[model samples]
Target: MKHIKRFIALFFIAAVLSGCKEDMVTVSYPEYTKAFRNPMKGFREYFGPGEDKIRAEYPYPYGSMTKEYMQWNMIEDDSSDGIDKIIAYSNHRWKGVEDINMKVILRVLLVWVEPWHGGKAKDPNNPDDLNGWHWPKGISPQVSPYKQIPGSVGAYVDPKDKTTPIIGGYFDPAFPERVAKLVEKIGQAWDNDPRVAYVEMGIIGEWGEHHDPDLSTYWPPHDEPEHVANRTWVPGMEKVLGDAFTKAFKNKKVMVRYAYEFKDYEFGIYWDSWSQPQEQVRGYEEMKKLGDRWKTQPIGGEITWNWGDLAKFKSFEQVVADKHTREYTIEQIRNLHCNHLGGITWANFNDPEFRKNAEILQKAMGYRFILSDFTYPSEIKNEKPLNISFKVVNTGSSPFYYNWPVEVSLLDAKTHQKVWSKTLDNVNISDWMPGDDWTIEKEAYQKPAPINEIKSSISIDKSLPDGEYIIALSVLDPAGMLPSLRFANENYFEGGYHPMGYIGVNKKPGKAMIDKSLFYDIQSDKTLRYNLNNN
Candidate 1:
């Protein structure tokens, strides 16, 4: 009797997973292989249309763009020959843009300006139009005319022809080693160039966004003392431009348009006045003393009333047209921890309700992981070892600064290919920030301690191969480890490779086929509904 029908199907799955560990939910699900959207995360394009048409018009999974490239005559001519044509036009505008894996967000403007509220330093009927550089008029490194250079131009000492008090152009005195050798040739040509995601630490002033390009000639200037010079918001030059963009981006992400005075260096705060609800809570109290430097830096910004009112917004006719102006722009993108914004040069994509109020705040921006519960062991033995348990939660707001590599693979089930892989390497996910004990807000909250109980035990790279395979999970992006992240879950498959069930490779091929699809039965353990913006 075939071993009593295999002990009645292993005692009917250990009595349906220990029958009701107090109502243990289990509603038949075992079938998957489709749910993918990983690229990088929302709204970032100022010069759009390509990157798969802005990820098919915003599926928000990577595809950013930026390019300032004036680098002050290639940083006063130490010229790394325009840093290899700006990394060969950023690797030829993302050569074959890997199905939306493009990246870029580079911003190298070593000072800029044109009619900067004050102009005519030249170009009067083309007095060789700026090709005859004469920067001394209203200094602020706000001089450009395409990095002037005729006669190797230089003749503008007029601070009223100083008897000894010159303070002009790029504030001479070896301008911080010419902006630290252009931040060491931009970390020797785009650090970790997996096309790079964020960079904007552009050597000061205009469009770089970090204040003081003579901040409108010192307006309310009496907080007095920014390393004295009667303050132009320059105290310790934000640790010399946050230690030169934390030593030239150790793997992308630098930001810095604001957060007023680089809150003591863990940089990653930007906000070009997008819906100023109290300057977005004073930019979250300017990083309330840095506690959670938005976990590994990256807040993102741009949108001071443009992008056509965020793509002609509607959120159900602004909940009767005026709901506190879309709840003060969704509480500044859910409490100012935005992860990329300013899509296609300020929203309003020919208005279609800007992707429906950007899917109601891109489902709360920044992190969004879900994968409620997962357990493995459907039969494996091709040089194997597999023990998994996942319950991930961080529903998004911030957290995911790097520690990016969390694999698991096995494909072939009908030629999907892959087969076996690993890489959990003690997963940390940058302490998985965000929280969800639930709270529309009323302070003194403390419930956010539970939901994140991720446990793992993966390994399966053994030599022999035998049969069925289709299990997936990936998080990689350590500058192109591939599997780009985007797991709010639906059992992803395509590029992000998520699948999550079906295995029977070399041995233990008897039982086990558990996979709670939309999490069935519903007994107790559930809380991983990662919102889902446009599914």
Candidate 2:
């Protein structure tokens, strides 16, 4: 009888332990099927002052911003004008951009060269034939002294007309000071603006690319002793502009044309000739030397198909269609950890094969966060600390670059409406890093992305009611506390939140109430929406 009693007691203890184990649940979510557009990453479109709408034949399926080249002359034509005019001009340029749910990557350029207007006529002698070199009212070649080249000749003389001189302000002593003032004024207007995504530290060279007069082969080579000096970047110019931009814009990320420049500053790189075969020296190799800089600063640029070796591919479609080139391009993007790209803005995505390939490329460019696992207790007592944990993985080439807030909420089981929500203070989404060191042979990152495990204990709201609720998670953009980033998970709800499992508040946990069928139905109207004044 004593042995029987001991056996029964041991059995009861074992059963209790089993019951306790069942109270905690660990759920694993599958990755989503398709790639979708997110803010501040992926391909970008071209935008200008009058162009308010995207004009692609088949609009990009995965982009969120427009790259606008803001001519310096357009913003501040006269040095005597007050800063108000510059502010007003910028505000007007982005007036309708927010309505389309897009941001602007602004580049304030001093020159634009031929084909695109901002300058004097190609035939400088003929005022009737206008071109794209836009020198401001007080800073024209006619007024400023050109000392970079000998004999008082301009640094960039017209190829067609040797007599006509196209001056770059880099050699002028007054140019840097004027640019500093302009940058300061721009910062005051755009640093806090929500519409602006990133600012290219432009103000030198043509198209703000930082290569002209000095490094340009655009005109016939002038090998004369005086012109030889012109084939180099202006001394101390990088530091001057780098310091100005760093001091001026505290909130926004700034990018320069090359990674080799601005070594002292923590500026990003915008490689104008991304993926070009011939750019191995100064472009591709230079960016590769930056090492892990892309982890913090954005690495973006246009894959030019109109010029260089890229033009040999004929069209953007062919560039990605050929297996060798396509693989090489993807390898470069992953290796460099590119955040955004252009050149595909004008690509015709009407072709099914091209569209499919483009989708793969889009997913490879920016941060694609995946919530692989979520664990929580079945029951939570009101006013008690509720401990929950989750694991995230970024499979894309680059990080999100911003430390946005992650929100946890309890939704009404019946209506799928949020009953209670709290933004998790512990999770820094930007630190959820992607993989690195891509290898073409393996077609994968040498170091696979690690699972970012986030464990947090949150306070449960004290309420009188006791009922079942569906637990959910979301990432807010902070612009309006709206859910803007969607996780690449199969458990995603239509309203930008991912529904985990069911839980009970101040009661015994009920059966799992998360109906996968209702996932498609809009649960809330307060979805991911963007507006200029949201900041």
Candidate 3:
């Protein structure tokens, strides 16, 4: 009679297993865990406050920030010594400045203003300002205080021959190789430098003043070729700079800044700004030709107009309010193949204006965020087999789409003997909005799979002794694996973790109790069970 009853139960289990294939469509799932014995279901709890779990689960080694802005705003002085502090700050935030690894290019300019030097070289009140450096007065720059060193200093040089004719008293020569070497030197000095990891060397010598051609008396007369003794953007400037970069950075990548106004040359073409549809398309063609040049799209004047209307630019706040302008700027950036873009020194950082601008830029560029929420169970108790659940969310506006692998290991609480373990694929969530939720549970006796409801079961043996034990749950983005969700900000629903629950672990003893939860709630007897003797 006992044997007949056992056969009946085995037949029923087979029937249920066969029916699962048909319901597979009704209940869609990506993948489930291997089977275990009597996995349990627990109450859904709200995630606690703070980022402790997230930090432990997904610590970020590097962070992204604006370099041009950090230098211009944070570093009050551009002195070599002053630079050390900036490096220190970067290291503190991102573990180490070098840990914030990303590609970058360095550009420098060397200008010679000899004729304007003479007595004007020394500061009037300081007397010892120049330490007695001097040059003739009449030939000097007519712009007063121009002789005074520009506060914004990186690398400057006095030409080899002071007597050499100075164009508009501003003989800023191209020193592509020299500038590249200097940047390399500075980058090496940092204890942990990010730029050094991917720094290219090149210089853009405008020769003329910032935007006005009148500042330099040399350019206007040069149309006749012989009339002006000096010229800017020499024919081979691009190649010369490119060679310097290759030599300095070795195997590293190169980028170039866009400063040369295409309008200056009659036969040549240039865009007023990157936003010009036709010009942008053509400009990239020309820029790519330079190959490995550090490229920076010009923002024009105090700020560029197509970027947004600055008429009401009383504060940085007003500038960011215009969404169209922000989107347009990002579009141009994408068109330029500048996914890892930078170079804006917003007058404000936290103001709504800047936040709006930063939001779109960050979303488009895909900046990684420090993990905000993560959790792994401390312990699970159920004879040999146990069930547990886990959750992950992106608390910040920044998206979270990386892998979070789950690992379960059973260990003897007293002697700490290894019992068993089940590994699952990294939990890749396609989307986790500001406020979202997900829950999962499964059984412990069945092989883990997409439809697995059980993890594993421990049968009591006469030779084994047992009391209390520990089950560990760990979440990680296993090394060498990219989450199933590859793109930066895309949302996936069919196969990834969604705000709604999908997978589950059943703690009930038999298959009957397992499927029962789907229809009715038998919270009392449905609980997982363990016996000290035999199964």
lDDT of each: 0.52, 0.74, 0.29
Q: lDDT of model 1 at residue 232?
A: 38
Q: In model 3, where is the ten-residue run with the lowest total lDDT?
A: 36-45
Q: How accurate is candidate 1 locally (lDDT)?
A: 0.52
* Reference-based TM-score of each model: 0.32, 0.84, 0.37
Candidate 2, poorest ten consecutive residues by summed lDDT: 216-225
Q: What's the lDDT for residue 127 in model 3?
A: 22
Name every residue pair that clashes in candidate 2: 118-132, 118-133, 118-134, 119-132, 119-133, 119-134, 214-230, 214-231
Instruction: Give the alpha carbon lDDT tens digit for every residue of 1-535 in model 2.
Output: 9999999999999999886553667787668767676778888777434433456432356777778777777677777767687778767666666554567898887666532122434455532122356667766452322234444323443354333333445655577788788888888878887778899887676677876544332223322324334233455677778888999989888998877767778888888787788787878888888888988889898888776777788788888887877787888889989999887766776789988888878889888889866888888878887788999999999998778899999988778878888999988988988999888878888899989999989998757378888889998777667677777777877667899989887666656546566665321222356655565
* lDDT for model 2: 0.74
Candidate 3 lDDT tens digits, 387-438: 3343332222222222234444444443434455455543433233222111
Return whichever of 1 and 3 wins on TM-score.
3
In angstroms, give how far residue 227 of model 1 lies from its true place: 14
lDDT of each residue in 114-200, candidate 1, tens digit only:
332232343355221222233322224422222222353222222332333224444555555556656667777877665566677
The deviation in Å at residue 40 for candidate 2 is 1.5
Best by lDDT: 2
Question: Top TM-score: which candidate number?
Answer: 2
Better of 1 and 3 by lDDT: 1
